[model samples]
Target: MTAWGVVRTAFGDHDVPSTLMGVTVLGYDGQLVEIEATAAVLDS
Candidate 1:
């Protein structure tokens, strides 16, 4: 799944991109894992 959001901070609100994924054999134990990742873009 994919999503979009925003982050609130003292500087300002920033755009955040996120994603949810399922993975197989992600670790040495070979277990099923669900991962969520998010990143914010800050103004320079």
Candidate 2:
């Protein structure tokens, strides 16, 4: 969780999955886990 703390998109920058740390993700490709905030993105 670096690079200015989670704020990258537009097909660039994003890594942390590390084999899906915790659980309850619903959808995810790869490299971007770092748990704590599931519940559908903290209730949106």
Candidate 3:
């Protein structure tokens, strides 16, 4: 599975940078799963 998301703070600052993430589930067992993620920041 794969997913994407954005993280934001509640400070209400327009200039606040944006954090974007991409995640993927590479492998899974009955009780464990491996995950990989990458993140980037964009200036606002």
Candidate 4:
């Protein structure tokens, strides 16, 4: 499964249905991944 973390409130695009937020993802070899998450699964 893809790991996710460091969720925080951020600017959201009006086109999206749910609230938008920022998140950090961890990768192997000290690499980091970032993505925009919707309020639908912020805690799931």
TM-score on alpha carbons, each prediction: 0.26, 0.15, 0.27, 0.20
Please write out the lDDT profile of model 3 over residues 1-44, one tens digit for every residue.
Answer: 22222222333444444444454653555556455667566798
Clashing pairs in 2: 16-31, 16-32, 16-33, 17-31, 17-32, 17-33
lDDT of 1 at 8: 32
Ranking by lDDT: 1, 3, 2, 4
Please report, as a residue range, the 10-residue window in candidate 2 with the lowest summed lDDT.
Answer: 10-19
Clashing pairs in 4: none
Expressed as tens digits, the lDDT of each residue in 1-44 for candidate 1 is 22222223432553334344555445667566555666566698
lDDT of each: 0.46, 0.45, 0.45, 0.43
Model 2, CA-based lDDT: 0.45
Query: In candidate 2, which residue ranges exceed 4 Å CA deviation?
Result: 1-26, 35-44
Per-residue lDDT of candidate 4, residues 1-44 (tens digit): 22222222243333434444454655556776556654554664
Cα error, residue 23 of model 4, in Å, equals: 15
Write candidate 2's Cα lDDT for 1-44 as tens digits. 75434444422553434333446664757746444554223353
Which of the two, 2 or 4, has more lDDT? 2
Candidate 1 lDDT: 0.46
Better of 3 and 4 by lDDT: 3
**Stretches > 4 Å off in candidate 4:** 1-28, 39-44
Point to the candidate with the largest lDDT: 1
